[model samples]
Structures are given as structure tokens and as C-alpha cells.
Target: MANSPHGGILKDLYIRDEPLKATLQAEAETLPHVVLTERQLCDLELILNGGFSPLQGFHTQAEYTSVVTTSRLPSGALWTIPIYLDINRAHLDTLGAVPGSRLTLRDPRDDQPLAIITISDIYTVDRTQEALQVYGTTDEAHPAVHYLRHNTRDTLVGGDVQAVNAPQHYDYVAIRRSPNEVRQLFKKLNWTRVVAFQTRNPMHRAHRELTVRAARMRHANVLIQPVVGLTKPGDIDHFTRVRVYQAIMPKYPNGMAQLSLLPLAMRMGGPREAVWHAIIRKNFGATHFIVGRDHAGPGSNSQGVDFYGPYEAQDLVLKYRDELDIEVVPFQMLTYLPDTDEYQPINEVAEGVKTLNISGTELRRRLKTGAPIPEWFSYPEVVRILREANPPRDHQGFTVFLTGLHASGKESIARALQVALNQEGGRSVSLLLGETIRQELSSELGYTKRERDINVARIGFVAAELTRSGAACIAAPIAPYNEARQQVRKQVARAGGFYLVHVATPLEACIKNDRAGVYARAIAGDIKGFTGIDDVYEAPSNADLVADVTKTSISQIVHEIILLLERDGYIGDR
Candidate 1:
């Protein structure tokens, strides 16, 4: 019967009676495959149409020029160039991997096996490219050329934002294609090692010092790409930040560096974020991304001991370097020297003579409070940025922020949660005391509630207001019991946003840090109703986020809180 078809399943067709047996069978071996998206397909089409010219790999110098070296200053001592993240995708995605297959081959560097990954949902790379004279050359007629580029997406790859772009407040970047378009624009440049710098803060002398140091150490070019988005509240806004950066451009080594603004929403997750930042830099065609101490901390953030310490991020990058292909350019924090009145390496600060006391906060505060930023603090352009960003100072958030007890932090953050009525300009009843059990019905002050109907009322009150305002709500007055906090979380989840940020500190740590000396006095039988004693303060179970004040500053905690709110979709990503 038809020569018994082929083999077992095929021969079964001879019966011609078995279900589906009469149908012809074909052997199509199934293997791993990658799915392409409309956007990815478009990108692929552009890439293919772009005409691969002896393209070896993503960072292939033979194919594309990494143009950071000749853009900076001091001839060759320092280099900073523009960063466009789309080119970075080639760096991280193509490293030791095969396209359209999960089978990653062996590594050429170490002959080690590489993992295969099938491409899934593809994300668009917000980019546009322009042809310019390539790295190390000012001649327009040079055979090598550079392509100016940037990502369209608003996400900042590896840094936290200090503030976000506001239509009324800042100059919105124009999202326009070039009126004069050049086809096959990037065909001419010779590629070299590219290094990218990520900053939410405006570029200052200290930053410049660190960048130049890293460039010289790595023998690569530099690209200064600062975030143009929501940065930390009260920190320099992007509009002014960009101006300062642009002002300092002429001072940089010409043809050795370039400056560009990266539009991105920062996550502020410290160590992990550093990795993401490096990848973005690589996508923008950089061979390196700088990692400094507290690299991505927008506000001090609750990272008690400097956002996982300086080396942690570097370690993370090094551990995963092959996957990212972007080198880790690590260095100590840069500080300004006063005796010589120049920026110097922190390590080179000769013991403790200078004791550079200037900090971003001190600088911002001095500017905001109407004090001049000293030359020792930042570059003149940087001062202008801070001066313009100084705007107005609101200290209501500061008094409570400056309270001196463990109980104060818990109280402040809790109290910090306000209702729409309390919105600065809402003109509505500002602060309303949200409590569970009404004191009118209570005879015993502390003992009688027994945790019954406690959190429910508090949650109801908070949720009702949040639902009413269509914004997040806050409930103060120690939410020590885990069950009570869970109730609040559940209630808030249904309404809008719910975050259990346990501003925790070890009892001993708190006592040691008890600036009010409440702990010592409590031991001497002075103060009663103290949390963790007299009043039971149950530790949180599985808190959504924790602002451990044991070592972090209030600014940092606030930054983390903002990040937590953004992550939970409670607050806008700005």
C-alpha cells in the first residue's frame, strides 16, 4: 500500500483505519527557536539593510567605530563621548551566543561552554544614528566617521533618577528624526574600545576627575551620559544639570570625549542597577561603564553602609562581565583638594590634611539656603546647576526628618504618609489622625485593645482616604504587629498601593544610636511605653521594602521609599 509508506507511523497508514492514520506523516524535528517581534523584525530589517560589512561581532571594531576617545581633552589624557543605548544591545546580547537558538557555543576566550538562550519578547531600542567624523579626528573628510545615537525609551539602564522630566519645569527633549538624513551613515568609522559613564548627578570636577582617571587607566574613550529624568527630589534637575555638563564640554580634552543626555526612569536598586547600567552603556557602543562608591544612589537611600559598598557593584560586573562584554572601570570616589584647589583622587588626599568636607547635600543645601558653592566643592558650571535647581526649600519634611530617636524614624515615615487633603496646595484639611479604636470608648490606654479591631479600623481609614483620593495613603502610630501590617497591606492592595517598609534597626543598634539617650534613661527607669520594651514592637515578616536606618541617611531612605513607591506602581515613575 503505497510501498508501506516509510516507517512505523507511516506504515500504520497501511491499515487506513486508525484515527489520523490515513493522513500522510512528515518528520519535522523540533528544536529550540527564537521568536521575533514586530519591533525586532524591524530592527533586523534595518540591520540587514544596513548591510553587514565584514561584521564579526557586536563590539567588532572592524564593523563599527567606538567613538569616545577623541572627544574629550588634554589631547589623549581624558575622553568622553555621547551614549546611545541601542548600540549597547549588540554588546550584551551577542557575546558568546548564537541567534535563534538556545545552544550557546563555547567561549573563544577561555574555551568554556556558553549558555544558549532563545529570544523572547523583544523590546524596541529607541535610537537614531547620524554620521560624523569618527574617533580621534576633527577632519570632516576623514575615511572613518562617528555616528551620533540615543535610545528612545525612557528607562535609564543602570542608574537611579534624581527627579523626573516635567513639562512645565524642564525643557522637554525633542523626539524628532533628523531633517537631513544620511543613508549608510556609519559605514566609514574604525572602532576602538569605548567607555561609558553613567550619572544621575550633574557632572562636576570630582566626577570629571574620576572619569579621566578611569579613561587613562583603561586606555579607552569616555562617554558622559547623564540621566535626563526624575532625579531625587531637591537634587539638581536635568535641565540645569544638562547645561552644566554642556558648559564643561569646552574644558574637556577636545575630540577625546562627548556629552549626551540619556532619557531614562531610574530604579535606584544599587548593585543590580550597576549591572543594568553597564549593559546600557555597552548598547550605546561603550566598552566600559564606570562603577564608583554609591554609584547609583539618588538619595542616601536606606543603604546604611553605602549601597552595598563600592566593591560590590564592581564584583557583580566582573562576575558577569562575559555576559555583558562591557568592562568594569572601578575607582575610589573623587574628592576636591583645597590646598591646591583641584580635584584629586580620594586615596591621594594625603592622610587627613584636606578633609574635604563638601558633599552633594552640603552643596545643594548651601545653594538652596542662599550660600555660594565653593570652588572646592564643584566646577563653576556645576554650581550654576545647583543654584538654578536650588529653587525653594521646604523644611516641614526636615524637622520630623531630624528627630533624634528610633521611634522618631518610625513615627516620621508613618506620619509622612499624607492624604489628598494634606496635599501641599490642596487647601483641604491637611493632617487627619487615623486611628482604629476611638479613645472615647476606651478606658484602659495601652492594654485593652488586645490587637482586636485595631489594624482593621486603621486600614479602613487609610484605604478609604486612598480610594477617595485615588492616591496612596499613610497610617502612622507604630504598626508593630505583623498581622496588623498584613491587614493594612491587603486593604491597601485592593484600594491602590500597599508597601510595608519596615524602617528597622536592631534593638542594640537603636540603643547605641539613641541620640536622645532614651535607651540609657529607659534602663534607669525613666521613660516608659518605649517600643521594643514596655510597648511590644513585633518585627515585620516579609516586608515589601526595608529602610534600615541603622547606617543609612534620611535622604537615602527617602530615595528608597520613592523607588519602592514607583516599583509598586503607587506613585508615578518620575
Candidate 2:
């Protein structure tokens, strides 16, 4: 039989009464509204659906402090991380949100009301202390720490949440199971002794071997519960990972394993996260959980040191073994033994035996370069899904972004690069010049810092679309702000390669080379907010290539950029 929920009962907060939901929906219109971020939305869905069992809503100040300090709720239940409803002071004042007031929480993707929170406490938290206590570090390199410092607001609004509706998910609806639903499925399948495996990455041959071995060792069935919500910031997107999971499902032994999606926003808290995962699995009817080395670990910190020891998660899970109500099935690193055509734990492998394994970094490199991935590492179906998602660089799209001061020869270089790419003829080429984008996409915008950032973002959006469609995009925008440029880089990089080029034309040279009198007019105070005169232009310090028109010909600079693309396998050598 399945273990009882964390606090002995699963709290399904979704209001199934249609009339009450309609009443709440109507009442929500008159109340102040709070739009949830992507992470918050994921958290809310789990909270409402009993995936985060025993929790009724976002944490109050007391609960937050208790969890942060001692890894326990105020009720003394084992809770590892804090779940907060963060709001800025401006929003709070605008909403007039005080204790006893009700606020509707709407989805940010669409302004659909999903839940209502009756405010119980509005307070601030010591984020630094929370970071140290929960994540063990304040390093910005940690994705959760970075999000806590930059993305999250300081003030937290705590209350009991009433769900108007579950967050609508259109993808993989069949596999998106709530805690109760999974528990019911396990009951129907007669899977009493179930071992759960939590993963955020795509499963491979080793993962299959590990889970199968774990199930056999425990005499249990297996549940592959993968996080479909916000994982570590550069981790594979959930869509691709889910498809890979789907492809690899048949590889599991018949009646031995099942796959389910968990909408979890992982904190990457390492040991604490592992414990939390075990508790969540227990709620989902798993009597046992497979805790691998560095389970839920977020690689390394800023100094290139691991955040936690290899066995820290396993040790912590074992420490709370009695209280968690789930058995920890610990496993070491599994490597393929070519001699026996099977996998064995690294510690158990014989000395001088030939072993082969592919690291995640190496797998990604192989995918990027169209190198062969062996059947020993992954199934063909799984490899096909991954390859389809990540095509080789030569077949993928890319963006070349050139930014500089006014009249800095960026447009000239962009046009030349576009023509060169078009002549090469593998993929369509797009040229997005700043003036053209200003006239077309951002006509209503001005030259203020905010407007300029929006303009650059608009160019980035179009370029990102072009890149996603397997085209070469050359964007010449005076993307003066480094932050905006970096944002564009991230946006385009998600689709394909993003190469930033700094057209480092000297300001004096720009003034001399001006075909129009805009630079002179700006200097003479005739043109207001003109770049290089009244407005600042923040140059990119991390550009992939730096070109100066004063020292090199346009053809030579274009050739150099092509060479960069060729070096990265985005283009074949001419």
C-alpha cells in the first residue's frame, strides 16, 4: 500500500463546486488582482491539485521563516523549501492588500483567474538569510539564487488560496497527473511497492538501467516523475525532454514502469531538494525513491566548486528516512561495461575493465556537431527525438547581431553579411536594420532609454523568429544597452546560435564618416536624445567578434564573421 501523505492528508484546494467557483469568479472581478509569474503559476497548479500535498496556499511569514531556518513547517512537518507569493510594494499599495482582503491570482500568459488568496499576512523576508539557509550559498551562478535576488520581490503576501480552475495545460494532458490521480492509478495497477525516480533531464540508457535495477532491488514497480516546470535555467526545455521521455517509455519492462509529469519549479537545493522530492513521491503513492549521487544537484557554483558533496542528498534522505515514510534506494554512478555489454555501478566495476559513458556535455556536443551517438548510450528512438529537437549547427538557424554608436558602419556590415549569406544559399537571409525596424515595428517608440531597449527587443524578436525557422538573421540595431543586447542574445540563443558583433568604430571616426548631419546636430543640441551625443551607448563587453571599420575593409570584416560561423559549424567552409 502507498504511504500516507506528508501531513497525513492530501489538501486538494481546487473548488469543485461550480456555483461557488462562479461566485468566486464574479467576486474576483471587484477585488485587486495579482498576475503570477511562470514559476509561481507552476507552484500554484501543484498546490491546487494536491501535487504539493498538505499545503493549502502560499506560506505565511512564520511558515517561510520556519522552513528556511529548520527545514520544517511550523506544524513540524518535514518541508525543505519556501513557497512564497511575492509582491512588490507598489503592487501591494495599488491593490490595497491588507490582512482579511481577498486578491485574485491570474495567470500571466493569459489573464485568466486561477485562484483567490485571502490575505493572512503581508511581510518582508531576509532574502540573504533565506538563500544561505535554504540553498547554502548566495552565489548568483546558482539559478535559484539568481532568481531570488533579481526576479523575486522582497515582500511576501501569505494567505489561503481557493482555486477557481486548474492552470490550463494543452500539452501532454494524458501524462499530467495530480498526486491523488497518480495514487489512484497506482491502486488500479496494483503497484503497492512502487519506487519513484525524479528527473529533470531526458532519460538515457543509464537512467533506464538505474531505475530498473532499483525496482528489482526493492521488488517494486517504477514511477518516472519528471519535472515539466521551470528547471535550471539552461537545462533542456520541458517540451523536448517530455518527448524524449515518451519515446523511451517502451524500453522499460512491461508492467514495471510508468511515466508522469510533475509541474515543479525546482530550486536546485541539492540535499534539501532531494528530501522534498522523496516526500512528494511518497504523496504520489511511491513507497520507495531512487536517490542517485548528487540528486537534484545544480552542477557547480561561481568558483567551479560543487554546491554539495556527492552523497549529501542520499545521506540527508536517509537521515529523514523514518519520518519521510518512504525508503531511499540509493545508487552510485552507473557506467557501461563494454566487456560484458551491461552497466555496473562505478564502485562495483572491476579494475582494468573497459567502460564507456557519455556525459551530458559530450552528448550535447555530439548533437551540435552531428556526431554519432552510440546505441550503448541511448536508444535510437530517444536519439531521434533529441536530434530532431537539436539539429546540427550547419542545418540550424543563427543570428548575427551588430551594435554600435550612430553612423558606426553597423548597417553596412549587416547588409554585406546578409548578401554574403544569401549568396552562399543554404538558408534564407534576413537583414533587419535599425531605421527600418523603427519605421515598421517600433514607429511609436522614441529614442529614450526605455524606448531604445524596446526597439532592440523588437528587432531581436524578429531575428529570433528568423533564426528559429532555420534562416540567417543579420540585425543592425544601435542596441546601446548591454542588458537589452544580452536579453536578445538569450532570446535568439534559445532558437539557434547567437553571435554578437561589436562594431567598434571610434566616435571621432563616426562623426567624420556621417553621411547625414545627425551626429553634428546632436552635438550642437539640435537633435535631442541622439545616440553618442545626449544618450549613452553601452558597448558589449562579451561580444563574439569585434570589428572596426577604421582598420579593416567591409569585405574583410564580413569574411571574418563568416570564419567565426564556420568555426562553430554554423556554416561549411567555402
TM-score leader:
2
Q: Write the per-residue lDDT of candidate 2 for residues 1-574, one digit (tens) a residue.
A: 3343232467688777889989988987777899999899988998898767778999999999889999999999999989999999888998898999999999998788999999999999888998899999999888889999999986899988998878888999999998888888887887778889989999999999999999898888899999999899888889999999988889987899999999999999999999989888877878889999998899999899999999999999999999988888999999999878999999998889999999999999999888999999999999999999888989899999999987889999999998898888888898899899999999999888888889998898999999999999999988999999999999999899999999999999999999888888888899898878888888889999999999999999999999999998899942
Q: lDDT at 298 for candidate 2?
A: 90
Candidate 1, superposed: residue stretches over 4 Å from native: 1-191, 230-235, 298-307, 392-574
> In order, what lDDT does every prediction score?
0.45, 0.89
Clashing pairs in 2: none
> Among all windows of ten consecutive residues in candidate 2, which has the lowest summed lDDT?
1-10
User: Could you give me the TM-score of model 2 versus the true structure?
Assistant: 0.93
Clashes of 1: 49
Total clashing pairs for each candidate: 49, 0
In candidate 1, position 76 carries an lDDT of 27
